[model samples]
Target chain A: MPPRSAPDRLLAVLDAFDHDHPALTLTDISRRAGLPLTTAHRLVGALTAWGALERDPSGVYHVGLRLWEVSALAPRGLALRQAALPFLEDLYEATHENVQLAVRDGAEVVYIEWISGRSAVGVRIRVGARWPLHATGVGLALLAHTDPEFQAAYCTGPLPAFTAHTVTDPALLRRMLAEVRRTGCAVSVRQITDDALSVAAPVRGAGGAVAAAVSVVVPADGIQVPALIPAVRLAARGISRRLGWRPA
Target chain B: MPPRSAPDRLLAVLDAFDHDHPALTLTDISRRAGLPLTTAHRLVGALTAWGALERDPSGVYHVGLRLWEVSALAPRGLALRQAALPFLEDLYEATHENVQLAVRDGAEVVYIEWISGRSAVGVRIRVGARWPLHATGVGLALLAHTDPEFQAAYCTGPLPAFTAHTVTDPALLRRMLAEVRRTGCAVSVRQITDDALSVAAPVRGAGGAVAAAVSVVVPADGIQVPALIPAVRLAARGISRRLGWRPA
Candidate 1:
């Protein structure tokens, strides 16, 4: 492949930072970005000066406040979270469980918001975390409502499994997707983590498209999936309404 | 000055996107970033390919969700807001006012979290918005408790006035800072906008440093400054405690 350009190289340095490797040294960034040491140092200096990255006392580089501020403007990220937060708070107060707000990103789900209940469950999905679509309740809820062609394409993929209960079989996942569309809610039963189960519903934007998903995770054994469905659906509707989606 | 390097130029492209300029065309990006058209096109192509910038239907480029996900990990931004949100919600519920959580950035305060009650005062400060140290409740609360040297230096500067009521005298500002220190909160009366008044308190981190500030904006008239003081202080203390702070 041809050598990357200036912007690609700088962005590659940023790409080197991820969920598992949020903090990195110059050498780490250089190696991960496939750039020479001098080039990495120059790019890092520019980024640090611009406040896209911050250097700690230990010389490890972490994302900075300026980048965070700019990123907050992402419509699907903080804007959606800002719109959904009040409803999410009400849901949390009503049911003290892990309340998560996520949006679909390709074959994965990107968690934009997570409200931790006083009593949280085992599956601690942090904000900005990504999980495969077939393995998460929020993912299935979003994927179910997505374009039929897109959904079919997703179901045709090699679905990875986290546990025995995960919908790794393409045929089974297609059936589950049909059920989700039929019922307007998704129940991911003990797939993400063995001890936890989740109920999720799609949140629609004013444009009537599936903009996001809201889910509540609880302990899997003796799970009240039926009872949780209404609450999850209500939260989804509440968020949808907040986003200007009116059921006429 | 020496010609800016490729990395610096690339960062300038990102810097061109801010609160004022959330969307940009290739031409706009090139002009604002001070790069040649050809250079800008090449860089934008790479950035769009890397998923840092998403091209919209109108051919405008926006900050992408992938970058937002990474930026969410910033400790002083989304992470702090995540920790402080519940208390902020409770405060909003209690007062039916605009509640805010902000952290100091340089000499300014950047609001990281905001919740507006339906009937709250018309003081609309968006998340990621920055305000000067002398003009807002969160700003005053943060500035008041900073190192004494820093406080004096700030107070000595030219205090810009929004109205005749705003504290323009350095001596008066110094006195107000003392009162804020004594009371564990800062009540900025009609500082930013004439009809708005705000009460703010310092939020401490695990090490008990003033890491953030919580504030509520209410109408200037019929203001219960004394009454709101305790509520705001309690909310701030609650968030600080959650962050693992314990008063000595």
Candidate 2:
């Protein structure tokens, strides 16, 4: 492996953490971060002393509250999530389904907020998890709102499909984006998982630009798209209103 | 200002942003962080490139999505908030007043989550806001659950009073802590604003230790504290259950 710079090395300590690996011991950190034991020891000490990492009674390290405090200031992360939460909660109460808030990060959509919908279709997404732009409902809604040129670029070869219903053809994907723009919403029916369908609407901010997308994950069988559309749109409008978007 | 270490300088740039100054121009960042123009530019460049900060259309810098995504992994921040949110929502829906979740940070309480009531209160607390352990209802609940030696140290003469009703005497504060522990709840009656009162309860973790606190802020006058106690305790109990706490 190529030797990393000081910043990269330090950041790798943090990089060692992920959804599947939230807790790690010093040996795990050394292995995952590709750091020598001594270097890992010093860096981990700095991180723990700085409260970037917390050591539990079991000597396993997890992300600490201090880093989370600093991170809560991210405008597109918790800031946007903060603005979208009441509406998400309202939608969850209405549907009792998985409610999610997502924003685009380059080619992927990162889940900024999620409320587990235990009674409805089971979705495997967790907070901060990500999926491609064409696979999930939130992803399609956000990708649909992007500029046509970027959309064209995104639809080129290498469209990986997760399920049989996922849109893999370029022309079909273009049509889907158009339909999303026209309806002001995107419905991915069993696109991510075989049994789950999602309906998503674009949320606008003060500038009248799409700020985020909200979606509901529901069972694919016996789905009612028409009925779900208005509720999703209403939640989107509520979030948009709170973001300072008003009708002209 | 003294020259800061490279890491500290980077952290200072982050510390430069807070609730009051969520967005900042380069000049604003340098001035607030007390760093020279050249150094601040270089650092901001690194941070933005690292996805720690995002530059807006107006050239204002904000904490970025990457940081927020990483922060969500913090057990004490988003993780704790996620566990407490449903119960907080129920409390908000029932009371129609401000609902908050907070954790103790040293001698103060740092609010990690907040749901603005339909009729918002006058206290003006936002997420990440800090209050002395002696002032806020959540703070009192957390302080009551913390080590007795720490509570004794906090109750010394340096206790600054917010309102006439604030508990300033060490002896009285000790008595208040005892009552909070005994009753399994805390009520800060008009300790913040004269028009405001807060009812808070401590949330226990799987280990049965007080992990956090939840509370509601309502107008001080004519509100029945006895009536609010059960609701607050129930919400706390619900969150505690989510955190893996069980009644013995």
Candidate 3:
């Protein structure tokens, strides 16, 4: 890559920290950020003083509270999660299943909130976890609502299957999206995990555009999809109303 | 103000967004960050490209999902809250009141997680909200656990009163801290609000140092503080154990 701009260089320092590398030493930051040791030192110092990064007594740097505070202002992040929590809680109360709220980021769905039910089927999802647009119930709900061009491209593009049950054929996946749009919900069984099945619905924003998706995941065996659909759609609609959406 | 370095200028653009001003225009960013308009434009563009800031259809810039995803890695932010959520849920279930988890930042307590009961007393607190060390149950629990010299300095400092029942006198505050230390929990009545009572207990980390506090807020009238203490302390201890704390 060509030489990055000053702001990009600073951002590179932050980008160096992610899910697998939440904590790092100065040397690690220098190498990961592609900066010299001295440049990394100076930028790290600036970030530390500004509270974007914090250094522990062990000399490892971690993301800081101030950065988290600022990010809490993200409308797509905590704000949406806060508005949807009560409904999510209600969904969990009604179904005793793993409840989730997620939004589309490009071709992927990013989970913003999750409330696990102790006795529910085990899920491979957590807050900040991501899944491709075709692999999860929330992902299917969100993908079904995207613009036609994007939806077409995504359907025709590479679809990685997580299990034998996952739909990898473009024609079949397109039909699934259509069914989701028609029925107002998506149900995926044993796609991400063998025992888990999820039912999800799209949440609308003020502009009546799909802003997020709400889902409840349970054991694939011995569960009724029809019984789960109403509760999932109700929670999604409740969250949509909370986000300022009104029906025509 | 003195001229800032390249990284500082970049960080200032992010610092411009907060609870009150979550979205901003270029001019607003320039004014709030105290940077030249051209410099602000450049920095904002870089941030937007890096997914740190997002611009809407109407030209307003808001904090973005990428920033939120990264902030989730913060040990004191979502990571801590994630570990404590199950215990908090149990606390809410048992007490049917508002449950909260907070960590001290300077002399104030910053709420990291909150679960509100539908019929619970109205609380002014929200996630990422802050309150003085002497004005909240979580704050008192945290303050009582701090080192003696720092705790003494904080006790002697000006105590801002939120209601007539708030303990503003240094001597009284000291006694309250002593009581909290002896009881292993803090009971603060009408300190931050006129109609609520809170019982909080400090949560310890792997090293057995106080890392956070868990609390339950309920209607102040006709409630038994003794009943709430065990649940609150139990939730705190449960969270501490999840954080790798072990009792000798």
Candidate 4:
């Protein structure tokens, strides 16, 4: 492959920021973006002037509001989350659990909205956090509804395990995907953390394709998983309906 | 001014998108960003490849999830919203009104979070939406706490009026700001919409500087504005405490 162009290098500077690194100094940006300090300084100045990055009083760089304003237009981010929030709130009100709305991106699920319930089980998930497609309820719901050809390719991957119950084997993962499709819902039990279980259902867009997923996470011990399935399914369907989807 | 650099031109391609123009074709982007078609195409290609922009099957471009994921780190956007969400939820439950959290950006207030209350007054505001600093409750709360010099300059001119009640006169606006500071809250009545009224309070950061404002909008007619003040102030204080602010 050829070397990255100037725009590509500039974008890499942004990509250097993530859940783990929300704020950084110019030196950190240079090292993480693999650009020279002088180049990074010049680029950071440009971004700050354009309102894409903010330099705080302490001289730490942070993602800025202008970028957030632009990113709010992302259909799978704030737009999708906006359409799904009312339904998620309903689900939260109904179950008083950790309600989440997520969309699949590549081999991972990115949570776009999270509504914590006052009496809900404790879960570590937050907005913009990503988890493996095979280890999350929303991920399974999304992956199950995707094309079978893509699913087959994904199943052959080196699936990482988080706990003893996480399905890592390709064949077992395939069975799990099939089950998710058959049941029209997905239950991820202690896949992410041993104390949590999530029930999720696929949300469809106007074209009848899966656009997102809604889920409810609860404590694993003595949880009534079956009781939560209908609520999650209802929330997902409500959001899908709001998105202009109709059951075929 | 000297000609904008190549980096500025590239950033202008992104600046072309806003709440009104979330989706654009190549021609539209080229015209809006003030770039020739070929230059726009090259920059768009780079942005598309870097996942900052995504092209739809119909050839329209949109801000992409990768950009959204990065922008989610914005301290004044998703991070602050996430921190204040529980308090916002509590406020919503307490009043069943249109609850919002906003931060000032130059002469405008950008709403970072909004919770639509069932059976409450209708509000035009949404998450990531902006309004002038003199035209809304949260805006006034934020402007009231800003530096005196900045506030004087902002109050001087170009205070656009949205409704007849909007405080457009600089002297009156200054007096209103003083009242907001004295009362520790702001009330905007029939400013944005003739039928709506909002009660807002300032939220302080760890350094005891006002960082954001919380508000609740309700129907203006036959409403007890005094009754809503305490609830909005309590929510603001709760969020401020969460941000590590302690009253002297």
Candidate 5:
């Protein structure tokens, strides 16, 4: 392979950080980025000077506030979350459950915002968490609205199951996606966790396309799935409206 | 001046984006970054491929989701806000007021989280928004907890008044900060806006140093400063404990 360019080398230093290894030493970054120690030191110094990475007193490096400030401009990230927060808050108030807003990223759903309700059922979801498209309500809602060819390919792809209830059969998952499109919502029962059920609805963007999904998770046992559908749809519609979506 | 390094050239491409210029064309970026069009194109291409920036259908560029995902690891940003959210939600639920969490950056406060109450008084604040240290309650709370020498220097700096009620005199500002330290809360009455009053308390980290501030903003008229004091302080302490702080 050819030698990495300067831009690639710099980006590699940033790529050394992730959800799991958020903090790292210079040696860790050098090893992770596959760069020489001297090169890593120079690049890290530049990144720290530019405020993309910060070094703590102990010499450990982590992502910095300036990066967060810049990333806040991502329309599919914090910008979307900021627009949807008030409606999410309203939904949280109405249901007192774990509310989430997520967008489709490849074959997975990336949760951008999450509001945990006091006394709500415990769900393994947080901001920046990811779940497969066939394994959660928000994922299904987003996948259901994608291009037919993309959806078809995803349906035929390997569907990892978190719980036995997670949909694994391509035909059954396709049918569920059909139902989601027809009913304007998706109900994922014990898909991610054994005891949680999520009801979700698609949020549209200004161009009449599904841009994101909003959902609420509750205990699977004694869940009022029917009662949740409308509330979830309303919040989705509220966020869609805020995003400049208009219904015909 | 020394010639710019490769990393500086790349960071300048990112620095072209801000709250005001979230979206930009290649030419805009080239101009803003003070780079030649060809150089900007190459850097932008690298950034896009690395998922730090994204190009829209219209050929405009934006901060991307990958950057947001990486920035989520910022301890001073989302990590702090995540640890503080439950307390902020409880505060919002208890008072139905606009809740804010901010950290001091130099002589300014950067709001990392904000939950706007539907019926709460409108305050000109948003996530990632900044205000001077003396013009907001969270700013004052954070400022009062800094090293005495730093605090003294900041107090003596120019205090630009927002509203007529903003503290402009260095001596008065010093007294106010002392009171904040003594009472463990900062109450700024109509400092930011004529109709808004904010009560803030500092949150400590594991090392017993103030890391952030949590505040609730209400209308200036008919405000109960005393009633809000304990509630705000409680929330701050709760977040501090969650962050591994222990009472001395």
Candidate 6:
């Protein structure tokens, strides 16, 4: 293949970082990005100078505050989270559980915001983390609102299962999607982690398109599903309204 | 001047979008970045394809979710906010007011997280916004903890005043900084806005250095400074502890 574009090379350097590797040395970046050490050095210098990356006093590189400042402009990132925060806070208050706001990207759901009370059930979700669109409550809520053709194609997959309750069969997933749409909310019971359950609802955007999903995660064994549905849906609707969504 | 670097030109495209200019067309970017239309188009295309920039149906460009995902790795940004969210939540729950987490970036404090109750006093602040290090309560808290030399230089400044109550005199600012250190908190009354007051405290990191600051914003009228100071300081201490800080 031809040489990578300048943008690709720069992005590859950034792609080297993740939740597990937020900090890296120059050599690690070079190796992970598959760039020559010299090339990595030059690109890292450029990035550091541009304030896209920061080099700590210890010489480790980190994604910089400037980059975060720019990224805060992302409509689906800080902007969306900002619009949804009050409602998310309300949901947290009502349920006293973990609350999340996520948007679907391809076949995955990327969490944009998360809030868990001090005594809330412990879950591994973090902002910017991605999970398959068929596994989580937010995923199910978002997936259930997609175009039927796209939904059908998505369900025909080799779905990965995290727990015994995860719906791996396409047929069952399709039926569940239909149910999610019919009921106006999705309930994911021990689908991701066996100890947790999530109740979610779709959020609409300015044009009334399903733009995101909101959910509450709680302990699986003693969840009050009946009580949670309205609270979750109310928060989703509140966020949707904040985003200029209006029901027809 | 030497020819602009490829990465710089690409970054220029991104820099064209700011708070007031979140959406731009190709021509708009070209003019803002001082590049020819063709060059701007090429860079915009590369950025869009790489998922750094997004082009909407209306042909306007926006910062994309992918960039937000990458920026979430910034230790001073989302990562720090995530770590402090629990404490911030508690502070909000107790006060039912605006809570903020900020870190000093150069001479400014960049707000990384914010939580305001729906009926909270309307203080103008959003995530990723910045303010000078001597005006806001969070800024004063962060500024008070920096090295003496840095603090001295910052205090010798061209401090901008937002309201009549803003402490613009260098000597007065110095005295305030000393007081912040002595009291373990900073209180600003109508510093940025006429009707707002803020109380802030520094949050120490694992190395026992002040890493970030947390604050509560409330209405200036009928304010109880003594009552709020301890709550704000407690939230800051709680976050600092969660970050592995211990009393020296």
- Indicate which candidate wins on DockQ: 3
For all predictions in the order shown, the interface RMSD in Å is: 1.3, 1.7, 0.7, 1.0, 0.8, 0.8
Per residue, candidate 2 scores C-alpha lDDT tens digits across A116-171 of 75577778788899888998888888998888788889989578888899889999
Q: Report how far off residue B152 is in candidate 4 (Å).
A: 1.6
Q: Which candidate do you rate higher for DockQ, 1 or 6? A: 6
List clashing residue pairs in candidate 4: none
Alpha carbon deviation, residue A28, candidate 4 (Å): 1.1
Which stretches of candidate 3 lie above 4 Å from their native place? none
Worst 10 residues of 6 chain B by lDDT: B1-10
Candidate closer to the true structure by TM-score (higher is better), 2 or 3: 3
Q: How closely does chain A match the true chain A in each prediction, as TM-score? A: 0.96, 0.96, 0.97, 0.96, 0.97, 0.98
Tell me the DockQ of each model, to 2 decimals. Answer: 0.69, 0.62, 0.86, 0.83, 0.84, 0.83
Over A111-227, each residue of candidate 5 has an lDDT whose tens digit, in order, gives 999998769999998888888999999999999999999999998988998888999999999999999999999999999999999999999999999999999999999548999
**Stretches of candidate 5 exceeding 4 Å from the true structure:** none
Minimum summed lDDT over a 10-residue window in model 4 chain A is located at A1-10
lDDT of 5 by residue, B21-76 (tens): 99999999999999999999999999999888999999999999989998999999
Candidate 4's residue-wise lDDT over B1-248, tens digit each? 45778789899999899889999999999999999899999999999988789998999999998898889899988889889988998898888888999999999999998988669888889888889999999999999999999999999969998889988899999999999999999999999999999999999999999999999999999467999999999999999999999999
Q: Which residues of candidate 2, in runs, are more than 4 Å off? A: B1-3
- Clash count of each predicted structure: 0, 0, 0, 0, 0, 0
Q: After superposition, how far is residue A130 of candidate 3 from its true place, in Å?
A: 1.4
lDDT of 1 by residue, A8-120 (tens): 78888888888788889999999998999999998899899988898988999998898898887777888889899888888888888899999998889999988877677
Lowest lDDT block of 10, candidate 2 chain A: A3-12
Docking category of candidate 5? high
Q: Write the per-residue lDDT of candidate 2 for residues B110-174, one digit (tens) a residue.
A: 99999995676777588888899888899999999888788888888488888899888899899
For model 6, what is the error of residue B200's alpha carbon versus the real structure, in angstroms, after optimal superposition? 1.4
What TM-score would every model get versus the actual structure?
0.94, 0.95, 0.97, 0.97, 0.95, 0.96
Question: Which pairs of residues collide in candidate 6?
Answer: none
Residue pairs whose backbone atoms clash in candidate 5: none
Task: Please give the lDDT score at residue A118 for candidate 4.
Answer: 66
Q: What are the runs in model 4 whose C-alpha is more than 4 Å off?
A: none
Q: For all candidates listed, what's the TM-score of chain B alone?
A: 0.95, 0.96, 0.97, 0.96, 0.97, 0.97
